[model samples]
Target chain A: MNDPGRRLPSGSEPVPDPADGPTDGPAGGLTGARSSDRTRAAILRAARAHFARHGYERTTIRAVAADAAIDASMVMRYFGSKENLFDAALTIDLRLPDLAAVARDDLPRVLVRHFLDRWEGDPADDALLLLLRSAVTHERAAERMREIFAEQVAPALGEAVDPRRAGLVSAQLLGLALTRYLLRAPGVTALTPDEVTELYAPALAAVLS
Target chain B: MNDPGRRLPSGSEPVPDPADGPTDGPAGGLTGARSSDRTRAAILRAARAHFARHGYERTTIRAVAADAAIDASMVMRYFGSKENLFDAALTIDLRLPDLAAVARDDLPRVLVRHFLDRWEGDPADDALLLLLRSAVTHERAAERMREIFAEQVAPALGEAVDPRRAGLVSAQLLGLALTRYLLRAPGVTALTPDEVTELYAPALAAVLS
Candidate 1:
């Protein structure tokens, strides 16, 4: 298993390294591979955690490196810079379920459940939380929000509904999260989950109807 | 007009200088009252502009003072701190129009027009813009967003609809702003004014119905 002639997983298609490269040394030439994977994963994990807790401006590469038990130079070598690390760490494709497949009548209920599950499912979505928090102050964060909604939610709405109306419906759905969840506005935060679902379900259905 | 002995607009108020050993100049005096008034107004104007552009964290009292053409000490003396300045600058009670008085069928159109007017009415509502931009990164800013929704929106909705269902109804309405106006999510942003009214009116009405 110690053949140095093997290839490593570089996160994409494996291109043949030059003959002098480490791939041709033996069959399992992964002496540096496992450590590299661990280092990359650790940096990503720490970046997510730090970005969640501190927001973008406050997160430092040195701190992320400390959190990952790696050198700062290693982080730069891997991700180029703190900004790149953040971009990579937070680049989540919100794989929303197919909106067209759900019965229009059940759209609100389904949408609400999907959002709750997504937020409640992962603690690592701290970047999302941080982004939500920063959206209040940062234009770039707002632009990201616009991009996610436009690219992810809009396309899923299908072509039946007029595009303008479709966009408005999507806006309303995301706005609930912005105001109720992110802002924690008083009455909004006071509602039980069940109440939110019951009330919004019909409203959501009507948007499509 | 530069009478040192002139009293404030309030004909009977006391004016005392701390440097003068706290001796009351008169039962009602205006000593430097005009200057103080001008300073207060200038601070509010500068703060609103600064808060709109830079938001809470990035905005500084020093910058605000510079914008107002006053000393930094004057800003501190009037508003105490940046927080106080922000509070004073944004002490707006959003006076939403009466929804219950409108015909049920016309609710969406009315709501659309109202929101459009309110947002376009005041450029000083930079706090709203800031919240839209930075809600993803700052807790305090996000909290302010919640507070605005809860205090202004929830009360209006609770009065018009079933109090129990108001939160959900409120969420949809607020969500409209978040997606359409703030984030400018694609489909939502593309809707014409009349089309937005058509799509969301029923959804809004459904919350109360």
Candidate 2:
């Protein structure tokens, strides 16, 4: 039920009609960059949905292309191979709140709240679930997860606390995602976000300290 | 290298030769039950390795049979399908400590340590990781995980704690397994089991309380 129109990259491109699909035809010259960008975004959106549902190993280029309403060759031309496509599909910006700016006492609560908001905010669009879901199924996806922890998570929290335990923080958050979002475990999914914050924020604070 | 001899069902039946493979011939009469058990166990072990590495959606009956030293037909004959095989492969007993017998103050620590022991005791043999790893890729595996949480984890801890929070406790523990065991996140994997208990047990206790 995804709107292809809404999946377009935010830019100066002339927005295509919602019913026309991506762009009218093969792109060229002035419209080429815009058309390609829209195509890539559409492909990434489809790819993330597949990876989230089918996981890294089972998700196929053909399936992703079919979902994107493009030819399989187009997906290949843009993203190269399945592995590269996977990497492109799940490149997430955690948009971690500026931890350095938070009051020292507020860091744990803020971090926990930010994560919950990010996961619950727009689940269908978030690539983190796709990454986590695929991580267990493929080594490359797992490595990508490790990279996100090292690059995004660690640096984001490093100034406020011992960066090393960022992995632990990620573990707690990812585990919650695994249960609440992906597995939809009854007890976990049943909790409201406020309840999650009340119950989980403390554990995150404990790990940080 | 798995020894088929070691995989046999523990019973009065004579063990097979590791050198000779599973058994001498088609089992009938008295050896039937034992032979079948050995074959099933062998299949499960291979299936776990595959599920651990490949995720559920991608693991095939053919591949599992090849690894188990049997014909693909035999695997189907016993397990019926990939989904059934996945169910059989990942059926884990958390072997929770007797929470009812422990002092109330020690419940959290005891539970955390038991999970660590279970995970680290014989990692190759532990199906919990396999279950978690595959749970995201397929609905059946995810349901199986939910089943384990409901049946095994909730009941085991129901006596000492509010059983409903069992899912939260499981979330924390499962998160640790995701980063430390499955993803092998360096910061987390570097922690000694005691350190994990020290850092994480507090969160679980907080959730429980």
Candidate 3:
């Protein structure tokens, strides 16, 4: 559980006021509620960056707190422990497109282009990359990776291909991330996102078709 | 440099004897030399397993010696420092078949089969997996991985495809290794080697052609 004080604001008033709710609140009170949300968001952001850079084993609540510029207890009060914090930090949404609607021939290009955009677009929004950087060395992250592939990727591909082939497709996509983003392999890194999509889309097309 | 004593044995007599060489030795002396060779091989084997399991940071010489049932000092004598030992352990020969000689269409199946055989053949022979496990976390291992890709894989593919596509091919191959072997993702691991070869060969063919 997080801080009791934050959850049940102490006996400062005899009765709760419905007007305190943001929709009915004075501007000052709404700003105060917004500030609390901002702090929570900041902690989550710092935890994600730490987990991304250092693996599950090496990342510490204290370091995440330091990065967030808050006390270490504040981290514990919010997330409970390092493991729970990791679970909180890795709330990934693949945002996979509706492949069923696309022309079968275009699935590979569409999928490849989407991932390239996801990875290169904004570092903060790239939760998949965060999981990937940790997954190679950490078992928890790897399990989460498997779940992501199964839950988000597999169903999206639907019955269009065999399940095994779908798994292979995930392997290829994750492999690109592993080389270009995580390992920073020279050749993979040297390509522009457009170049990667150009070179990689056809291969994905082969797997898809 | 490793231990000087191992490199330069203390002399019983100054003159070098041609008969002492394994090729022309008395049967009894040859057996003794072969036994020594086996011990060295055992140490190297244990070292590879340790490095594969623990990565560069955690694998210690003492631990390798323990696994091999040799004195810790013998490990040092044979390998010098952990760095030199790692170098000795990772003497990988991809032994890639001659792509040019193969029928153009069959290149994918051959390459995929070769890698599957190499990976599943023997744990002792899997230095690339060891490097992959270490490279994610260790800077030195990552550099070595880059060199292996550039020097070995790139040259082998050699103008068969564009350089960037060659890199993508490597990414796909390495990604399979990452997911199936290192991460042990269940979906990828559930497939037999033949199944892998059958499924992966065509995707690779796309990359190559």
Candidate 4:
């Protein structure tokens, strides 16, 4: 579900400078709040890396905590059990662009480019790949994956095509991601990012139109 | 990498039926050969089903033997070991149509139709699905999958397009199979086969052309 190799930012929470004391006033409260947020974000990033690399059954909260450089007890206190941690870590935002705003013909190229960028932008940080890897074996992950596609992707492509057709578009795009990134199927991986976009854009365009 | 659930024909090698002596003539030899072939096929089928359902790590020789209704010794005697049995069972024949013979414009529709028919034809008997399920976790299975795509699929489509483009085509098609069949992603699986064909064929056509 998550890969452990990716490094999380050091120092789970930013420490307040000794010079800035309680006399620092309202800024102190904001800094404290921000520190808690940073800790949570760090835990989540570490958790995702573990899940992406090891999968649901094998990934342990302790390992995630170790990777995040936090105490295991802190992880448990913040996220409860491993399952809860996984649920928190894998909250995906596809961030599908608004198709309505783009020219109809430009949709396919836009969509392909966006996905290629997402996948190439960062391999270890990609939550979608985590879900894809885990969904194959874990029932909960599979359900989450289904929910993401149905709720986020389908709505984003609304009225550009029928719901069913939109689903097909998703299948095509996801397939490319699975082969290129997750499976590293040689042929698919051999192509440069631009080459992939060149080859896939038209096919996606056909689907969109 | 292989499942034991799909039935292989019984008998890995032909044995002369005890009822028919070697002296019984050519007819006796033919019947014995056919029986052995059937047994071998039965064992392979069972192996595929088991691997597909349980994955490489969990699938066992005894379970495959039990599913085939053959003695454990017989399973070993035929396929040697669990790993060897897996290799034997998952030898896929995609039976990709002769693309060179097909009209270039019709290639996409033909290719999509063939795969849809193959997947929908018999979910239980499909070796491809077994390989796909196993490939995610098992390095050996994953390697086999890569080899199959590179050797069988890439070569089949070679004359029609560049090898790199053929690989991209494989990614798209395999991705569809991954989401719809393996992950059972809600949106992709909901479509009827015809609906899928309608949506996917054009995209594939664009790739092929």
lDDT of 1 by residue, A78-127 (tens): 99987788766655566678888987767679877677545544433444
lDDT of 4 by residue, B1-209 (tens): 22222222233333322212232345555576565665676677778777776676688989888877889898888888998988876677777888778887877878888887667654333477777766766668778888888888888875648877787788778878877777676667777777778888899888877
What TM-score does candidate 1 reach? 0.75
Instruction: Report how far off residue A158 is in candidate 1 (Å).
Output: 1.8
- Choose 1 or 4, whichever is better by TM-score: 4
* Candidate 2 lDDT score at position A90: 64
Docking quality level of the chain pair in candidate 2: medium
Measured by DockQ, the strongest candidate is: 4
Regions more than 4 Å wrong, model 2: A1-36, A57-66, A69-74, B1-36, B57-63, B70-77, B123-126
Tell me the TM-score of chain B in each candidate.
0.67, 0.80, 0.78, 0.82
Q: B138 in model 3: Cα distance from truth in Å?
A: 1.5
Candidate with top lDDT is 2
lDDT of 3 by residue, B1-209 (tens): 21101211121222222112223445466576665665677677677777766666788999889877889999898778999999877666676777778787887788878877667653433466677766766667777777777887888776757777777888898888877876676667778878888888888888777
lDDT of 3: 0.70
lDDT score at residue A202, model 1, on the 0-100 scale = 78
DockQ (model 2, Cα): 0.56
- Predicted complex 4: CAPRI docking category: medium
TM-score of each: 0.75, 0.79, 0.82, 0.82
Model 1, residue B105: distance off in Å is 5.4
Writing each residue's lDDT as its tens digit, candidate 2 over B64-112 gives 8887889999999988988788778767777677788877667778888
Say which prediction, candidate 2 or candidate 4, comes out ahead on lDDT: 2
Please tell me the interface RMSD, in Å, for model 2: 1.4
